[model samples]
Target: MTNTNRASIKIGGGVNGSKVEGGKIRTEKSTSSTENNVDIIIDKDVTNSAEIIGGEIHVSSDLKAEIQELLNELAKNPITRKEAVAIEVIKEHINDNPSLKQRLLSALKAGGTEALKAIFNHPVVSVSVETVKGFLEAS
Candidate 1:
């Protein structure tokens, strides 16, 4: 679900939590001094699929850096062959691995797009994966 979704989601006031299922994300208008917000908690079930998918989807640090060295690669660059492979892997993994998808999505947001790219570009992947794995497990 995309928080960008502008639908006015009418709901009961006493929500311990609110979340969108599947591809839909909900964003709510704010009444407090704080800004409007939407939150998506990564699901418990999606973790394994995300890891296997993310692993198969690797690209070289060189390729990732070349893409990031530019200005706003996400908006401007067509998906590179390198990225395409990863995307396909992710798509397949996410098909049934919602938990992993949520965890990865959580990571991507914990650090926004650029930081996410830098992490992906990390040269030492085993350590990087373990770091991410440990962080996820610890949490």
Candidate 2:
């Protein structure tokens, strides 16, 4: 033989069916006492999330700086064969790492067409830029 026990929880007045609009959640309440008015507000910027290739991609600042350094190195005039190979390796790494690719795409989006041109003009780096372009086009 076995015994069964049950319990129920009941919640009282609260904000119901609240929806986020323009990156904000707002709720207001008032009591019989004039001083008892209550207000709740939350604010956030969702625009950046919309701009990113993937929903809210997060890359560390250090990684972003390091990638920028690599791009700057590639952009330098009279690049050597070793540097070209290194660029290829970087491309491979970007392809292998989704975060890095997202970071690259974010940088490109931030910099716009001029940045795209700069990357595309470099024969060694253009391959990776093309890959990024394909992602942009697909999205």
TM-score of each: 0.26, 0.31
Clashes of 1: 10
User: Highest lDDT: which candidate?
Assistant: 2
* Cα lDDT listed for each candidate: 0.34, 0.41
Query: What is the RMSD, in Å, between candidate 1 and the native fold over all Cα?
Result: 16.1
In the range 46-138, model 2's lDDT, one tens digit per residue, is 332333121221223454455555665765644422455655656666777787677557645644332333333333433345544665445
Per-residue error (Å), model 2, residue 11: 64
RMSD (Å) per prediction: 16.1, 21.4
Residue pairs that clash (backbone atoms under 3 angstroms), model 2: none
Prediction 1 global C-alpha lDDT = 0.34
